[model samples]
Target: MDVPHPFDEAVATVKALAPAVRSESVPVDDCLGRILATEAVARIDVPPFDRAMMDGFALRVDGELEEGITFSVTGTLAAGDAPTGSPPAGSAVRIMTGAPMPADTNAVARFEWCEESTSSQHGTTAASASVRLLRSVRAGESVQPRGQDGGAGTVVLGHGVRLAGAHLSLLRTYGIAHLSVAKRPTCSIIVTGSELCRDTEALLAPGQIYGANDAYLSGALTTDGIAVTECSYVEDSRDAIRTALVKAVASSDFVILTGGVSAGDYDYVPRVIADLGGQIAVRRVLMRPGSPLVAATVEGAVVFALSGNPAAGFVQFETLVRPVLRQAMGWHDEPFPASGRLLHTVKQKPVRHTRILRGAARIEGGVVVVDTEMAQAAGQISSFASANCLVRLDEPHVEAGTVLPLRFLDGALSSR
Candidate 1:
């Protein structure tokens, strides 16, 4: 019997076989959640020019401004108004937030910090207005310098960066109307089991259960922005699995099959892949709950055969499948594993295989604490409801207070 591939070796194989990065031009409005294929260079400076940072009076101060210094109001500047003329010395311009700073003016005093006064002739307003300084002002105060956000020709966003809402807004600030992003990958999912039923609304026959693999796999891929081209629930027949594989490989960049990879009487996925001229890259992995994982390449499309058990499939998908898909889409910066100390001792039958179990991780008193008290069964999915991470236990007998590696799930990395 051949030895099962080590977990790390299997993951490395999958990554090495990932498809090369491909790029496509997309509008900036549609770039959210897309990975950048190339570095985003700024064509123009953000903010473009120096402007007022708040609603204030733009001042031309020759030296330190002291309280009670008066100045004549020359003009009013609102946002989008160009500076047509400079305010002479000892003069000020009433400026609104985001308005271009007038020529020769180096500082702005907020309206609340200045006292406006105008002379009245026979109860009528005078043509000239003046303001009294309530506080001191200096150069660069309340002034937003040009290119403060980003300078022209600067690489604002690096390659392989995943665009978020804030990233899109920043690109818009630099007048970036279009973006070069990695081409989105397509996926096809096949769930094989003669006893699997699709509809929960209808009464199930004997020895049949409603299928959750399809829903979980499809939803997970969709949530990550991968397009699921096909989803099939086939019975445990060799012909049915073969037919599904042929169609899936034809249309998708990758194919995912849950069930029929283990040494069962009805396990036909691995054989079917071989029959279709596909080469198996990884026959199995040395990991608990998902040791029967298999990776194959067929007709330029990679296939991942996983165990049908909900928790097992979920672990394999998160640990191996997701990372490869990310690489194919040009995301190179894999998240570093989070480190935390185990809160209690955990003992299991001595085995060399790695045990990946659902766990909850939290920071208490400036220290990371990991708790793996939930049910760690291959078939169970209930424990995932409260699990925030997956704890990797390499040894069967683990001592308490030992630091363990954790991988965040459900976007926990964002918060961490």
Candidate 2:
């Protein structure tokens, strides 16, 4: 059967994979990097009331230009302390930073601009009662007014927002001990091939290769916060593949199988998954390198069978599986391959979608230029290892200035 275009199949499968689980309440401390399920409304105004922004005296400011203007020091106000009535007219309060502004006080003057004296020093024996303003104070200067940051009932964080470190801090400031966030998805990876073995020390025969897909796949999934609960390498046998699939589906929300989905006679992933009552979503795509990609649902768990070649498997995972996994983890933005102009000529046939090799890139004169590291091939893992971005070459080989979509291995992409 002719395969569908890579972009078409990938987009279709992602849209079909519905979210299996949903949001849960987690402590604010653990909510960082998770998606918020509901808007977090501020229960109380930030600062709660008008408070001082500096260690100064709270006084009613009027036109005062004299070098030394004496005022009676009525009482002291510290942060969290109750006001001792509004500073009586013509009298100022000794207020510390963060202290609530007295009922009638309108401004604060820094200590450097103020001088103090005691009546006792002048006439002998009485409480200190004098303060002088060496500089005038302005209304609302150095004061954080009530609800300045956020008023009560204001939405500090909107629904569908991804929580970051700053969001956690904000939650703490708002006294939110717990918040609703989406649950993370769990995955299981199965690596199969009779020639593939996990033991690196074991000497490979003429047709054998050490298993690298399992390690790479597990690492990629874990980096995105998806837990890989089961990882196993099995010989290329129908029974072995079926057993592994059943086990993986039972234990994980998603199963990612690397190898054994191609058209070769020995490829057993597709047949075994179907025999075990799994529904094949798509068997192949019309893209180079990763054309044999397959996705299915075995006993309700999604299974992604990728190419045996490292490069092909990685591309398939990024294009097909990454989106579903990220969505399950509450990520709003689906991963899309970035677009950039090729720095050099990349030759490819116009018959199929092409994924070319590329290294790091930089913006020069407002254009993203990708440096081609090596030729494009499905089995060339070396180029993929050294590549930071996949310079996409669509059908019809174009010149150096042609804009093509680029996929960054690190999940970042150039703007198209």
Candidate 3:
């Protein structure tokens, strides 16, 4: 049967129910991937002084690099040491990379460009001898003046940018030890099934399987930069679902219940949600693998009920749950989703709902192409591991080489 909720509308509805995550001040070391809440202004100039860009001699020059000019080597300047004295036009100081250039010196020539008279060119001590310049350099050569990166009060980072390692390095360069960043939205996962077991080391009985939903959901949430506050499994009882959900809603920003949302007698998540005063935002999405998806909101938190099938839940979390969580976490939705060319023909029964298939996508020679594997079934969990995208094919017959719509899985979106 065709599902009632359209995919686009379902996404919009899910985002509408997402709670806004708050911001907090945290140490720069812990701010990786966190969205900045405010502009990060440079407190001081980067490098903070006229510095040497290479291990070379620092001296004054007027024009293009000229050869055969010689100077008396007075002293060596280490990276952290203060310059002993400035060299006049006829002399130079052997400077190390990152060391401050001596005053009145407008250029630094590496030891490669000159030869020491009697001293070996290798050592921390001064080269007390006359040096001959074998290479010529223009004025200001290899010299990085102060404030080349940014002066104080310059906006080194703007608000809403996700902090990466490079960003933290800059923050550290300016002595910014702390950062103001948005906190990840907190959520809870409630796995509802009687045949699931959490103990992996124990022997399993006939009807019991190792619990996959809770662990997978928790990992997915963490990878998306969301905080998983609770993850618990419940029996196939309405009361059990209700009790677990009530606590989850009160304790977190959202609740995700895996299983028990469909029309089967064992499915009680929908009824329990309504009994708990939660309004059902969506009952069924027009997308296969997760057509039985259900959404509701209560107690200032949205509740998502996914299918018992592992692949279904995986797809739903990637396409539906992740987009909402990303929005709530203060990130922008991808304006233009990447697409892939079909590498093989796909045949499925005709239906009104959109079909979501797991496919491996790759870009070769500037073209995006995708292909499905043998394990592309709703109950199959292995198919998703190799797949980087969910190909959205609305029609029954998809021919090879046909361009199909696709959405890169959470955290896997990349520009072609």
User: For every model shown, what is its TM-score relative to the native structure?
Assistant: 0.94, 0.88, 0.90
Best by TM-score: 1
lDDT of 3 by residue, 1-416 (tens): 33468888888888888777678899999998888888888889987999999997888887765788778877778899997776766888878999999988888887888876856545774445777778778898888899898888888899888888999999989878788888788899999998888889989989999888888889878976888989998999998999999899999888899999889999998889989888888889888889888888988888899998889988888788877887777776641266889989998999988788888787766788888755877878886777778888889998999998787764353445
Residue 196 of model 3 has an lDDT of 86
**Of candidates 2 and 1, the better by lDDT:** 1
Segments in model 2 whose C-alpha atoms lie over 4 Å from true places = 62-68, 75-85, 117-129, 201-206, 354-356, 365-367, 411-416
Clashes of 1: 0
Q: What's the distance in Å from true for residue 371, model 3? A: 0.7
In model 2, the worst 10-residue window by lDDT is: 119-128
Clashes of each: 0, 3, 4
Which run of 10 residues does model 1 get worst, by summed lDDT? 119-128
Task: Supply the global lDDT for candidate 1.
Answer: 0.88
| TM-score: the better of candidates 1 and 2 | 1
